[model samples]
Target chain A: MRPTVHHVAEEAGVSLATVDRVLNRRPGVRAKTVTRVNEAIAKLGYVRDISAANLAKQRVYNLVFIIPEGPNSFMLGLESELGQAKLYSALERINLDILKVRAFDSDALANVLDGLDLTQISGVALVATESHRVQGALARLRQANIPVVTLVSDVSAAHRDHYVGIDNVAAGRTAASLMGRFVGHKPGKIALLAGSMLVRDHVERRIGFEQVISAEFPELDCLTVQEGRDDAMVTRSVLADFLGREPGIVGLYSIGAGNRGVIDVLTSKPEYGSIAVVAHELTEHSKRALREGVFDAVINQDAGHEVRSAIRLLKASIDETQVIAKQEIIRIEIYIRDNLP
Target chain B: MRPTVHHVAEEAGVSLATVDRVLNRRPGVRAKTVTRVNEAIAKLGYVRDISAANLAKQRVYNLVFIIPEGPNSFMLGLESELGQAKLYSALERINLDILKVRAFDSDALANVLDGLDLTQISGVALVATESHRVQGALARLRQANIPVVTLVSDVSAAHRDHYVGIDNVAAGRTAASLMGRFVGHKPGKIALLAGSMLVRDHVERRIGFEQVISAEFPELDCLTVQEGRDDAMVTRSVLADFLGREPGIVGLYSIGAGNRGVIDVLTSKPEYGSIAVVAHELTEHSKRALREGVFDAVINQDAGHEVRSAIRLLKASIDETQVIAKQEIIRIEIYIRDNLP
Candidate 1:
């Protein structure tokens, strides 16, 4: 039979309340007593029944996920995954609440962060819009001892406890490498499409993409980037206009959302196959495009993984438990038609 | 407060013992009483604390992992992951035992399975070697009500409860697609390497690789496969012989282990960069090879993910619980130099 707290208390020669205080790291416990309890626990090989302890305490972690509200398919998919996570939230003893703010609006994001009830919320995760005001709000949360995690887009400041997303710069470099290889020896201009440069992920992706294109693929020239606000309609018009105006366009790299727009324009063109396309995120539109030989590659970060990792990190912080670092890494997933899903 | 069994029993006008029987699906409970208990549970939104319940029952799952004993880096890595899992086993109420048999010895594997004490083992997981003898053993286990999970490699017979691995056929096709694109328009032979044709994963990969090469890349010809038995010495000698005799080798596809030999042979040749290389399973050797430009790409199924998934599947099978399908999918991860992690 496994040892229990009673065994630990008897071995430590302490009262049950004293053992409990040491186990929970509560105040008013002397260092000598805490050491005695810990030695007894280690010697007895007593693995704490965390679930039973939590049940006894009725500890419910109140976690909030703050994401951008937009027409972006990827963000919508993230929200959908959070909705799915809610089904299992009760079993995990987590009360998950989602807050939506205007996309890329630093003032709105900061306002939302500043207005949070610190006492009610155990942790916070947000798709950050990098700005001084937002950084100040994050600092305030840190001062209040609330753990903060950045999801999807991370901030430049070091206020967050953890970042549960892929390395966007590496993702961009990978896209560039694939693009360079796919459009081998073709001397033509490459068109770059992004959601907005205001976000750190987009800017980092652009930097990595441009670095590779210039360093290796000298035959290809990158055209000026056009911001489409991640909207399908706006991206479609921007891409259509770019294609009409630019000559010798041989490659297209969609750094962010608005792949639906890129696909629409490419499919309607007669010489679509000549232009190698690489995009980010896998949605129904991108998956179909990949099958139809429209998009050569898609870079993805699993939204389910990110959401689940965030929850685990928040819970671990609240519990003061160790987490497996490797299991939490959000990999940069590269998908082609042959290896979808 | 979260509802307890007493609350459920009170709401249902039944005894606590009756509620326990219904919750645990034990026999001797009337259908009407079960319905009443279930209704009360639903009305109270009672989510069972599985860890606490298991603690109350003092349930410790004894799980066995059977794998082939070899110098194969991937399998070694899998074993290492299992070793790491052992550290957390006590906390999880799991007792993990690893059993090793001779590599590619069907009778040895079958004997190991046949010799298991079915009464003590809660579940079994194995890296399967498909054969009639093994199939019979699996069938006997199934009849004895032992939950079994196939890990890394799957068996053709449907005796196993779940397969915790990636689709090998799709992985092969993905390799072929990448090989064809990397060797664009080059008319030459492509060398195929495998551990052995005795395993199902290697055979399926060969089929998918050939299918794509014949249908799409007409310029490239697939050479006869070399069976290295996943040994470094055997692979090095065989590949060196092939390189000496075969003319105009433009690409290489490694379907299984023994990548250390491939890297040694390729690195020795001055024209290594001329050949496009794609191999399976990322290890220290493959990772370094990729960084050194010796490997164009590495197709990987995370060993850690596979091991963890197998454990989860086995436990869920034992508990008769539903698994999150999306979370369990083992993806065919494509790694380039830029995105190593």
Candidate 2:
């Protein structure tokens, strides 16, 4: 039989109400008595059913996902997914709020972070910036005992509680490996496109891609990356001009959110389809391009998984419970036309 | 402010105890009083926090997963995942029980289903056999108002409440597509292997694979399927014999759980490494084979994901709550060595 609060009370030789105070972390219990109850708890190996206890106590979690305000398809998808998650978690008493800051603005993110009412909010999940100001804000939040989870683009220097996204470096390496294999023994030049090197996720992906291409496919020449700034028009014009100048480019890897632009350039020229093209995310546009044979493969991190994972991590952190690392892992997904969902 | 039980009682013109009786669906509540309470619930748009109410009432879910007992790595992996899930859900007041019968024994499965004590069990998740007896057993369980979820191999004819696994047909098509692409434009024959055609999952995968191969890659000829009955030794000998007899075979798609046998044959003959091999599941053996370059790709339905999804579906079914279809979906995951987690 499992141990209960009564068991702990009996073992500690304390009243049920006194045991409840210790169990709930409520004040007014003597320090020595608290120690006795804790020892009894350890002896009995009692585990409190956190969700049930929280529910009975009418504990509600107020969470916020601070995302970037943008027209980026990936961010839009993330917002849509977060909205759905909020609806799904209504009964769980999780009030999920989405806060948007100007895209890529470190100061704007820091300002938002500073303005947060920590007393009312249980936890925060954010797309973090690398700026020291953001890091300082994160440290303050931590000091205040509110947990912070970094989302897609991480600010590792901030010492966040958890990261709720795929490993961008691994994702990039996987893309490079796919590009190398799909191109099949051909010695040709490969081009890479990214949003910007300033963003950690894109930079990590670029680093991973270059490493694999150099180590595994020495025959393949990797050209310098072109920054698209995650803008569709910029990606299209820049890629089209590059393709015209480099006829020898046999493969292209787009490691950011300008796939629409990449797809436009590739679809306009039927010859470009013969070149191995790989991109990130599985938005409606990417899905269609893969189906139309404009893109060979896609590397994806499910937005739903990311949002849901963030919620779980934040709740566990708030409850001071152990997180199941393996269960919380957000997978790096690969999609081809045949496997697209 | 959110509507409370007091508000509900006031709206229904009922006493607090009467409201409790109606909410709990207890005996002795008049039908007219029940109707009044339900009308109040709808009128106020009051959504009951099921988890909270269940906690207050100390409701515990007794769930059983009827899995096939086998040496098959994938089934073993599923069992292991379920065990871990049971541990994880201990705090959720979920008592998850695993009932094992002889692998692929329809009568044994039917007998187990027949013997279920519905009074004690809240719900069941099972890997079902497509037999009249099994279907009849499932029908009786449903008639008893027990929620049933089909896992891994599905029993579609039984009209199970939910399916907590990948779409086998889609998984097969994905494998075929990867095989065709990885092997390049060479017009070579491909070999297909399976546990048994009697299993719905295997048969669906075969159908999906053949459909894609026939439609997209007319150059590649698909050879007849060989069943290994999910035995590693049987798979090894059969595949080794087939490889010897068919020199034109350039790719092999193993659609079932005997990948160790497939890997044994392939690794023994270094020359066979040229053939692109794709299979199912990501067991330790498959992971090593993929890393060692013996297997090119693996199509996976995460065992952990399946077990968790089954639990969620069963709990939701018991509560008569809406299931989030997207969140519950078990992804048809594709893994190459680069992306294997």
Candidate 3:
């Protein structure tokens, strides 16, 4: 028995239009409703015949991707992927509309969500939040038939259709394992540079990082986490202050953006023989630092894949296409100087 | 006046159907024709009116990404992106048909290219080679009006519409900078590992690495370049031999695939306390070694973005749409344990 749209709508306790929106990831649905519908779909295991379904529907699947706004290497990388995607847009059968949002603005995001054109977009892929209005708006959109896929961060209350990014906690664990291995059962002072606690991705990453550090690298004492907020200025100040004060710090882990500051602190003044440094995102700043021997390691998630994946899922919903689950998963990339592929 | 496909075809000296095929990235035609068409398009600066063209034509963009085969983590990551793209395909108003070819076989790829249904697809994206057949096939497609974008390693001879990925030379330079900085201005021996010299990306990376090392890292001596061909056994044996002979080797720069053997060799006896290591791609082998500290850094290019970008460009050709250049570029991602986002 094939699971029809009517069945999905009935299971989700929504109207037919609502099901259409949810499946297609259309705008104007509440987050809560979207989750309920997704939950229903997961339970039903509904799959569509993409080619036939799309041919019948005119195949207009418009999805939006909201990325954090910053000049940091990671954001820059994300921007590059998005630009490339636009150059060779993956979905000609559907429409992928992109909207870039400024980072750390909950109210602004809420206001934007309130005013988004519901008729045009099918779904959204965004770095998430824990705000009520955000959740409420998503719920409304869901009721209206729009689906949402969280990127980089999870929006738990909204319960979006899917998440198209890496597992930060696992990435953290991987980071810890690397730190343990490279440092080798030796005890030393390690400093951590975090971007911000405002974003869910950063917070989760920190949690996972701390967990791994506690379990594996206990011999190495960790310095207090510095809030860089992905700013070069703040990162420079924080790192400069730490390096000056804690000359004994032999290892460093910067979980935030803006490696230019770290590079400045490490290479500008006279330094010791060796200090193990690890950070995230392979931006120009970080990459240059790695080449210069200032940064030790970089852990990364490809922003381009996440963007493309989010759009594809939105289209599948709208087109009623069969999507293969095994291929959509995103993984973490770990970088070192020797193996820079 | 806006340049049209007609202008491009006339400039390229091909038939209207060939121009249409090239503009739409449709299959068929010979490789030489495709190149001539591309050159014509370049000469005429004929950009498609993607939105209107797509709305009018109802075109479907199908892109094929040929990556190295087997359980390579990076390749798997690319595969995952393809899967996810299928799920959210509705948003982009297109369809992506992805096929994975065996690794390191230019002839095998040429064979696969020969079997493609040119009329059905809008374009083709491949990690290419300078093979005669591959070029001929591409030329024919161009003549038929099918847009071909090279993924990862490019096909300059094929005159691909675009190369949707990072600059390997820059990546190598970046790697060298990191290696120099991490090792400090100390005299030490460094080992180099790679998959093959057949790849332009690898060659460029090696050149960049050597260029920087010789120019800047006078104290840090590079032993020699070893070709592993992305083979695990070969890398393990090579690394073991290198480690045994070069006891003073304090650094490793793997510019290729198959790092597991290297990891296994390094971790077997635990002589990895101060051996600074750098590699490319964040695979299971690299990830495990990174966690264990057998490796120090990784340099990565997002395969997902490249695949998606290629598909989008193809679709745009079919739809005759405008592609935003800023959105589709793939960037390098550097990872460290602390900032594993």
lDDT of each: 0.90, 0.89, 0.74
Which candidate has the top score in lDDT? 1
Taking the tens digit of each residue's C-alpha lDDT, what string does model 1 give over B91-147?
788999999999989899999999999999999999998888999999999988889
Ten residues in sequence with the least summed lDDT for candidate 3 chain A: A49-58
Q: Tens-digit lDDT track for model 2 on A1-341? A: 67889999999999999999998889999999999999999999899866567667688899989999978899999999999999888778899999999888999999999999989999999988779899999999999999999998888744798888888889999998899888987999999899888899999999889889999999899898999988899999999999999978899999999888998899887788789998999999999998988888999998888998999999989888877677788889999988877
Interface DockQ per candidate: 0.72, 0.63, 0.10
Between the candidate structures 1 and 3, which one is better when assessed by TM-score? Answer: 1
Model 3 residue A228 lDDT score: 83
- Runs off by more than 4 Å, candidate 2: A24-36, B17-39
Report, to 2 decimal places, the DockQ of model 1: 0.72
lDDT (tens digit, per residue) of candidate 3 on A225-252:
8888788888889878878888677778
* Proportion of the native interface contacts kept in model 1: 0.61
In every candidate, what fraction of the native interface contacts is reproduced? 0.61, 0.63, 0.08
TM-score of model 3 relative to the true fold?
Answer: 0.61
Tell me the spans in candidate 1 whose CA falls farther than 4 Å from its real position: B42-44
Error of 3 at B59 (Å): 7.6
lDDT of 2: 0.89
Q: Could you list the chain B TM-scores for each candidate?
A: 0.97, 0.95, 0.80
